[model samples]
Target: MKNLRVLDLTSCVDLLVTPKFSGCKNLAILILERCSQLVEVDHSIGDLKCLISLNLKFCTELSMLPVEMGHLTALKELLMDGTKVEEIPISIGQFKQLEGPIATLPDSVGELIRLNHLSVRDCHRIRKLPNSIGNIGISLVELDVSGTGVSKFPNSIKYLQKLKVLRMDSCFFKEFPPDIGELTSLEEIHASWCRSLEGGIPSEIGKLHNLRILRLRHSTISSIPMEIHQLSNLQTLDLLHCDMIKELPRLPSSIRELHVDDELKSSEIWILDNLRLQRLSTSKLPAMIKLSNLQTRRLLHCNTIKEVPKLPSGMMDLRVGDELKSSKIWNLHDLRLELLSTFIIQEEIQLSDPDLVDYFAAP
Candidate 1:
């Protein structure tokens, strides 16, 4: 067993024992993914001096990791996603080469100077990061803390000079430390659901020229800084449920997907020109005289508009949350209407007109 190099026990639903793999002094990798019933890992696992990797993903019934895991000096990679493990042992920093998602690291985690990848998604109980987290300089490459309860990011994050991706979605941040713009090497960011955030986005954000994806959905932000257009490589901009936003800066031409709610005014509609817009939604249609190149539009909860307008020739899907009179709709193809009320339609007489048959066609 000393020669064991890899152990993969994924989806073994009823597994109940912590593997006694410490006997395999040469073990290099251990993978126990989706072992839902697994309850523990033996503390003696620290005896595997040559171990390089360990993965325990989606082991929901498991409650903790061996505190002695810190003694595995040769371990290089560790991954635990969707598990019930409560807190990361302080001894974790001893590994020197640890990687993957962490819930809450021991204050000693600062000692892991060689860590390169980390994701702490959905760890709702973690309120703050270790103050020493910033001292581990330049080694980390990816960090995602989305869906955690942490309200502020550790200033220590600025030390990760090699970081390529940082995702902090749903963390309830009221504002970010201004120095965040100093992470010049960052390539992507997901900061959705920061409901209390106010003021304009920091102008320094444009300095991350390498950024490719920015998701700020469900935030309270009312306007995007014109500097955002500097992200020449950005591909997706998701601003769903930003109810307070009234206008948008001209989007980057490189953007391929834009998902915004219908709270925008008519003047903002002109921003859609010359881009490959994919999904559009709003409470009311912009009063623009013409729309072309749009592919899909979903209108929700609009009380003012009485009819649909002449849409682009390539428009494929149109979903209306409320029914409109047949005559108010000028030309509709591939329409999907929901929650129609006869009383509402009768009040808007255009729908009952006999000539309406030429314009409305269901798909």
Candidate 2:
């Protein structure tokens, strides 16, 4: 039919193959999602020049797409989230309106100037992104490359004036482009668990006035950029398991939740005019004594104290890790203990490994 605007074959579990679309020149939307048995798509799909949206999600048996699909210049959105497709066709760059993804992307991906959102998460085989990716700077908003082996980011990323969210979790990038501060519109940047990234946060990062959440937990960076104090909208700062960092920097006034290593368990809490800092994990009890609104405190692997130090007056819950074995001095505080939310006690927690469990129980 010449006027076909939409063809929804969703949940066609037995559909083994799709018909050629050579005659449907005006077809705008074609959805074959959840077609469990679909093994292939006809190459004549390129004939549908008016096709704007094509969704082939969860088609496990389908692993490849006909290269002729690239001829659909009017294609705007392509969804292949749960498919077996290993690599994106190089010709796909012709679809300037393409938006998102799953396993792999082609170098031609940089040609999609209109792409707004791209997610190549858990695609371990993709070692690096093409320098051409910088071409999407004009309209690209969100880009996620978590769980890959990408070693570097394009210097052109700074050109993405409209970009907002960027997630690079569990990757091994050596260092971020220093001029990253040029992206003035960035909001949330989650690059946690990137243990191999060497350099600390770029000073330009503080220029992101709209940035709210910055999660760099479990990374190898040793120091925070002094410029971080300029993030006027930053709310959550996570630096957990950052063992190389020697000192914690004072944060912006807007910070509400602060997550760091056990090293800062005793540092002073910022007593600002608008103190939104709430929960913290520290080893020293002195940090907890000053904050009036501090709610939750975790004592992680703190082993030295003979007696539990005084906690914040308004503190609600306290979580104690696998440490503090003293059952004798647990009565250091004589105040109303029943009023606390979760009273932390000294005890040894069981490990997951069989040998480690027996080792902890020995003697």
- For all the candidates, what are their Cα RMSDs to the real structure? 8.0, 10.1
How well does model 1 score by local distance difference test?
Answer: 0.69
Clashes of 2: 2
Ten residues in a row with the worst lDDT in model 2?
Answer: 332-341
Q: Write the per-residue lDDT of candidate 2 for residues 1-363, one digit (tens) a residue.
A: 888889999999999989888777899999999998999999889899999899998887888888988898888777776677877687987664432344556778888887888767776667777777888888899988888767678777777788899889999987765877998998999988988878687888878999999888888876778788889999888888888777655577787667765565535434433345454444434434344455554443344433455444344454554455555434333222222333344453323445434533556
- Measured by TM-score, the strongest candidate is 2
Which candidate comes out best when scored by lDDT?
A: 2
Residue clash pairs of candidate 2? 265-282, 265-283
How does model 2 fare in lDDT? 0.71
**Displacement of the residue 174 alpha carbon in candidate 2, Å:** 2.4
